[model samples]
Target: MPVASLNDIKAKVGADLGASPWIEVTQAHIDTFADVTGDRQFIHVDPDMAKQTPFGGTIAHGFLTLSLLSQMGAGVMMVPDTTKMVVNYGFDRVRFIAPVRSGKRVRGHFTLAAFEEKRPGQWQALHNVTVEIEGEDKPALTADWIGLIYV
Candidate 1:
């Protein structure tokens, strides 16, 4: 969806939401991320060692799950049009609610939390994102993220 001005986007305070798209977390993906982040902990890198943990097998890193918010949220962004360059501004709150075990599918449910003007041609938006595990009671991650847009 196209971006919108702060004022225009504000009208969507009670916007209807779209369904989340599911994504599978694979061992290969986790290994790649571990290599990228230089965080090759056994819980996330060694399947055999991870088996003894409550999680049963190597799990994807919390940050890796958090990073998928954008893709899952893409189908849920409410802005209709009015800006360019929507960049990752920051996060308000972030929590790793549950372990994302490898081979499990996770999805994100995005809800617009707030939108305000930061400048004449710039705006900031807050999204409350919940990433749920395919069959788990607890969500894998929950975070309030910010995005900055320029007209």
Candidate 2:
């Protein structure tokens, strides 16, 4: 990711910020997420049982794919040179469009939807993101993610 001036970044509203490297969604990743979130649904942790479902095998939890935005964004997001800190400000919208089966690769595609100074030293940014599943026509999810940057 490149470090740019606030104005420079703001100029990129509506521009594609590129994509993160492909990351395989493993059964282990699903299990860990399920354990941590206490959402151990059979479809996510029980491969044999999951095989009976439409997905054919265990699928990653929706939140697991959503949470991966952090890792996915790191390689694609831009940082302001004067930024002091940045924090998640939640999402405007998020939709899980498809189930990511275990072993499938996924990556995020980001576009700068909005960027503006909300206060003297605070900036709010909105990124329109799509998490694409390798070899699949449909994406796993889409979200309008917001972030607060304090400089």
Candidate 3:
């Protein structure tokens, strides 16, 4: 975990938070995400059916890849010692730029885009997050993700 104070974060608002370790996007992972989200699209759940599609095989759900940000962010950042709680504020924008085919590896790279104090001991942060597919030129997705840190 990378620890930084409110002043430190504000000072480096546009700094790279760094990338997370690569993780495989398996068919099972996609299937479970689909089950949980009730988003059983053939391209995500049925390999045989998806093989005939443009992707040529099953791919991960965009939201599934996006959801990994929480886990990935953990590897890239730590809650500041002064903060007692943190919560997802919401996303300002999100775009799925590429498909993450099942069994492919993916990782997240983040930049701190914005930081502001909403009130005493409460701060708002926006991060520019990109999910990269291994060996691919284009990223799988990009988002302006926001979080609320309470101190």
Candidate 4:
């Protein structure tokens, strides 16, 4: 995580934080997510059947890609050292704009959208997050994510 002071965080509002390292979305990962979420959609798990679809082959679940933001954002955006805890408040909006086929690489690009002290020692932040599929013009997804930091 990018450790910073409260004031430092405030200073970075509306700034582009950075991009996370690329992460491969393999078929194994997709299958495991399907098992855990019980979303056994043919497009996500049935490789042979999925080949007939326009996606050509199995594609990762949209939620699976959305869930990756946490892992992708851990170091890309962060709270100050004084913060006792942090929480994923939720997202204002989320759009799955493109498909991420199995075996593809993706990364997250983040921008600090909003930051305010809701109350003393409690801060709320909004992040504009985009998941880019490697070598693809269109991003896999975009979200207005929110986080709460406790100091």
lDDT of the candidates, in the order given: 0.84, 0.95, 0.89, 0.96
TM-score per candidate: 0.91, 0.98, 0.95, 0.98
Per residue, candidate 3 scores C-alpha lDDT tens digits across 41-138 of 89898889999999999999999999999888987864566888889988999999999999999999999888888998888888999999999999
| Candidate 3 structure lDDT | 0.89
lDDT of 1 by residue, 1-151 (tens): 5455556678876553554778999999999999999999999999999999988999999999998887887777866475567788889899998999999999887777787778888777788888889989999988988988776
Compared with the true structure, the alpha-carbon lDDT of candidate 4 equals: 0.96
Better of 1 and 3 by TM-score: 3
Candidate 4 worst ten-residue window by lDDT: 74-83
Off by over 4 Å in 1: 2-8, 14-16
lDDT for each residue of candidate 4 in 84-117, tens digit (9 for 90 to 100): 9999999999999999999999999999999999
Instruction: Name the 10 consecutive residues with the lowest summed lDDT in model 2.
Output: 1-10
User: Clash pairs of candidate 2?
Assistant: none
The global Cα lDDT (0 to 1) of model 1 is 0.84
